[model samples]
Target: MSIQKPGYKSLYLYLSLSMAPLFLAFTPLQPAYAEEIKNGKQVYEIGCAGCHASGVLDAPKFGNNADWLKREQQGFETLVKHALNGFNNMPAKGGNPAYKNEEIIATVAYMLSEAGFPNYADRTGVKAVTTASTPKPAEKPATVAPKSKPATATKSYKNTNQFNRLMAPSSEWNPPQSKDGIHDPENDGTEMLQKPRVAFEPLANSTSGNRVDWVKALHNGEINPRYDRVNPDAMPVVMDLNIVREVKGSMPNVVYPHKQHTEWLDCSNCHPAIFIPQKGANQISMASILLGQKCGVCHGKVAFPVSECRKCHSQAKTAKK
Candidate 1:
């Protein structure tokens, strides 16, 4: 016990070791402001990434300084206003009305910060502070569910030079038929007709197409679309089957779910008429579909557009062992 270890501890070292806890206790730690930044990143992925990631509809690419700098030239407040409100081809809050003002601001800040513009959020005087003493989060809005409509594009389809030409933009989606470009505004009866939104709100929602999950809505008893116009009691001959069409190259194989289609349409709508019942009897391709044949007969017109490739081409191709 008398023989000490090889190393010797000085009196100063002992004192410093004893005070280490106090030193750490008095030291300042950064606030949990990263929470806001993380939320911003999440918001971008959920809503903004769809267009921004790929620069669809001329949206600024995520990390592109050139595109972001031009927008940054506009005052920060002005940029915030544009994001909060609709601007050009981009819809407000990237089409999700559910996004909070603070969240949107945070997201824009995150984008700008990541794109080589540091302290952009601070420039606007909005503090991104979070701490243990922070209050409970605000209660969510009563309209928690997404509105049963996609964001109406500001640009008309006729004028848009982008891909996915099927979707047209309108200031007022589901407007009164009289005001709707398709219907004659002079027709008094058109105005009397109920707005499409009013009828659609109750249906299950989707991100694309008419924004109504018509199949799910039917299954959930929200809508009972009559199979026959004259005979209201007529029921569809629902088929629960899937046909997987193998695609060339890296794209996933197409899985055509008959159950979804049959819930609304009869077999006669396709079998023998459009898609021949016999396998390999019918010739199907993207070219033909774009020409309004095969699946295109309904997809681009009534069902979800072909632009949503993952919806149909869902089956992953496995490597040969």
Candidate 2:
């Protein structure tokens, strides 16, 4: 007999390793019911309070039976469906998708019970109970007198010439530059600063009417007007200087930034002249611009294109003559 020894060390190590997982599996997990309800309440206050509290847009008011009863008539399942899909003004899931369907149901149930609906019950299985008791008032604290410290002396300055100094004119005062560049004693820096500050005046009455650049607008898919011909290589050059001058009237001729336009748009965007393609062509007019046609095609539609007189005409008002 070779000492008839039992080989238990290796077996013990193997059994210990196997039991580790079993021990972990049986460990008790703490309940999360209280924490879940706390979180649910916070979520409800932020997302549901807006419409539910005020009954906005026919929303069921919080703690109100009449409104909830009307909604419940449709049945609980239908109500949950409505909450998920959203009805009329109520955005789907109250516009917040982070809420779990279970949480929504639980919160709705809580709200129903709070509103005096007897049928509502806590799905979490927790019940709250109250006990009545007499309350006592808080006792007041005793008062004590405060000790006073000796006052310290402060230095004072006096000048006999104070009145004369007040009457004297300020030495920093300077005369203002007149309209002619010559300095005038009558008008001073005070008058210069008092003048109103210059402000930006938009070309049009409302920026809403202003149009975007044509090519840029087309490139942005803003305008989809028909084009007579599609020329990839062709750019939006000034078709004629004379036409621009006539259309602009008394205002400075807008140096149509054609290169800037072509960069963003295709020829088809403004081709056939913002009108149907006819060889001799259709007449583009100021009336059309106001109506959002031709130049109005994009001025207000997508590009800074408009026939509003003030937009272009008023530029001279702020310009240095």
TM-scores of the candidates in the order shown? 0.46, 0.30
In model 2, which runs have C-alpha deviations exceeding 4 angstroms? 1-40, 118-121, 124-321
> Per-residue CA lDDT of candidate 1, range 15-49, in tens?
45545755554321211112332246666776688
Give the count of colliding residue pairs in each prediction: 0, 12
Q: Which stretches of candidate 1 lie over 4 Å from their true place?
A: 1-171, 230-233
Model 1 TM: 0.46
* TM-score result, candidate 2: 0.30
Whole-model lDDT values for every prediction:
0.63, 0.44
lDDT of 1: 0.63
219-246, model 2: which lDDT tens digit per residue? 5555554433575445443332212322
Clashing pairs in 1: none
